[model samples]
Target: MEAFWAAAVGIVWGLPLVILLAGAGVWFMLLSRAAPLRHAGHALAILSGRYERRDAPGEISHFRALSAALSGTIGMGNIAGVAIAIAMGGSGAVFWMWVAGALGMATKFFTCTLSCLYRKPDSQGVMQGGPMYYIEVGLGPRFRPLAMLFAACAMVGCLGVFQSNQLAGLMQAQWSVPAPLTGLLAMTAVGYVVLGGSVRVGRFAGLVVPLMCLLYLGGGLLVIADHAERVPAVLRAIVLGAFDVDAGIGGAAGLTVKEILVTGVRRAVFSNEAGLGTEALAHGAAQTDEPVREGLVAMLGPFIDTHLVCTMTALVILTSGVSPQAAGVVTTAQAFEASLPGLGAGLVSAIFAAFALTTMITYAYYSVKCAKYLFGERRGGAFVWIYLVLIPIAALWTPTTTVNIIDTAYALMVIPNMTATLLLAPRVLVAMRDYFARQEG
Candidate 1:
């Protein structure tokens, strides 16, 4: 089974997909003329409710939309995923991750802008938006095949199995909580929020995502501060390692430069999910007429997830002098336990659980969108139960199996999304330019 998954992941995440993912981001950057990156300050303003219009045509506030998006992106990927990257690809993987995050910001701006521009109202009168919508509505029904492809893959891709599997494993290892018990608790918490619908998902994410981030980043920063002198060396190693084929704790495992680069990019993409269209599903629900406004707001996700949060995790692992070769959660825990002794690991465990729980809630909303897109509203809404059922099953799966399933699904989903986003980017670019021009006028 492990060998099969290894082969599947290798094929799906091979050079072609890497090029597609990174190439799409570069293409977006050049096409937008870095407009979105330049206007990140403007994005922050929209996120801060500076230009909120509650009466606008959408289901959630910009802040809530962003929080919901972040809730999905900023979880175990930042925790265990980064650990995996360092273990496999070395400190240099961190460098490639930064690269992916920077390009991801631009890619997200394009995708989210299109989401709002091409949004459609559902039978219930709530507006619907996402890659599938833009692929069908913006590009005409000729592109409906791509839209369906994305929806199908997204239903699989957005399951949060990685989050559930990692969190459950950590709980069982650290606290000896049974995996079934952990899954039950997570499913109950997630179901409580998600069963209430998108409004509840948004409200819960808006409240918890920020607190979770603060808790994790705060603890990580403390460890870095304690080893202030080693920070420079760690940063230097990251840069130097990027080109070192013999980098990382697993170097003796015979990884090459290409493998190192790909590892970093894959892990970073897993964390931020910039081109996978999940961010679009969330931002597509923002209350705004100006799609560019939401586009800019959506741009912050990769920065926050991969750049800030993942970087914090990497630095803590490096500075604490922990071996990156250790098991993902164990390495992170050891790093923390080294710095603050008894308190640090416990805090990370609690925070990981919160991260996992919130991630499950947000992805539940994404899964619903995918299901609805495929099965029609009446049948699709009932699919939430299916998502709830997967939580505990995922908790029991080995991490290797869980990650491979998600990664393969993510790869499949990214193909249609990046394809559609590239084709419709001109429309988003036009909308973005006009919105900015109106602001200037």
Candidate 2:
């Protein structure tokens, strides 16, 4: 069952990169007039609270929403995903990851803007928005089923499977802990915050995201400083390897430029989850009337997730002279251990555990939001409980089986969600333009 689910999830999640993101990214890039690239400084300024207004709507602040989403994305992906990318895709993968991150900004803008536009107050009068809401509201009654499908997939596939898998992997690698035990401990921590609802989750993310990022970045920088002399050569190797005609990526069903570009971008999207409409679920809860405000905050997720944290992992792996030939989470573990020696592995393990647990908890809130949108707020508690209980079981399982299942489910959720976003994107774009024009006035 796990294997079956994993394949389905992988295909569902994986197919979008080739079809949805590839098409939507190219199209949105032109539509936004390349705002993500050209006016990136403005995006940064907006995130810095320079444009914040006191009269915002919603539940929490835009900063908190962004932090919640960032906390989820900037986890194992920044560490392990980068490791896997370098291993499978080579040093060139990092370059492509940047490309994906850049394109993903546009994706975030369109999807998250729509999230705010289609948002509605919940039974408790809390602002609710995400793929589920947009799917139901934007697509109308005829499309309600798709919305439910997405909600279920997100709750089980993302919140339950992927989160636990990553968290368990970190724990197992770090202390040689048993999967079920670590999963139970991790789930217990998550349940404490998630059962308290979005406010608690948001607050938790707001605090943890910044602190963890600083610690990880500081540690990574220390290692990089020690290997400063090898920096230039490492970069050269990346560039050269990317274009290597004789690097065995060409001849027999091997990687071409397009393949490399696509795979890297896809992985980056999965890692940061910027454009996939997942993070927007968390960010849509921001207390802001202006969609662009949240969108601006939302843009920071990819930058922090992919550019800063992912870069740290990449550099550590490259500088440590670690072989990227391993599978699972070990690739990253090896890199960190090699660089820092005795303390490196333990430190990386702890960081990964922190990141994974935080990510899972934040994601649980997201999935709960989706569940509430599809069912009722009352049903949410039941779904959340079931998800929490399943974590330990998932952790004890094979990593391949678990990740594949979660990945496949992730893919399944994205398809309907992506289609909904593409259909309603014009609405978002119009809202953005109108909001910006009024602000300028």
Q: Name the top lDDT candidate.
A: 1
User: How well is each residue in 1-441 modelled by candidate 1, as lDDT tens digits?
Assistant: 888987998899777776777888888989988889898898898889999987899889888898899987776557778877887787888899999888899999999989999988887888999999999999999989999999888888788677788788989988999999988888888889988878898999899888888988898888888889988887888887788754444331567777788888988876787888889998998989889999999999889998889999988877766453554433666777777889988988887777778878888888888899899888998999888888888888756776887778777888888888888887887788788999999
lDDT, candidate 2, 107-157, per-residue tens: 787778777877877898777888888788888979988988888777756
> What lDDT score belongs to each candidate, Candidate 1 first?
0.84, 0.73
**Which segments of candidate 2 are over 4 A away from where they belong?**
1-7, 13-16, 53-55, 176-181, 236-255, 322-332, 395-405
The Cα error of candidate 1 at residue 187, in Å, is 2.4
Span of 10 residues, lowest total lDDT, candidate 1: 245-254
Every candidate's CA RMSD: 3.4, 3.6
**Which pairs, if any, clash in model 1?**
90-248
lDDT of model number 1? 0.84
Best by TM-score: 1
What TM-score goes with each of the models?
Answer: 0.89, 0.87
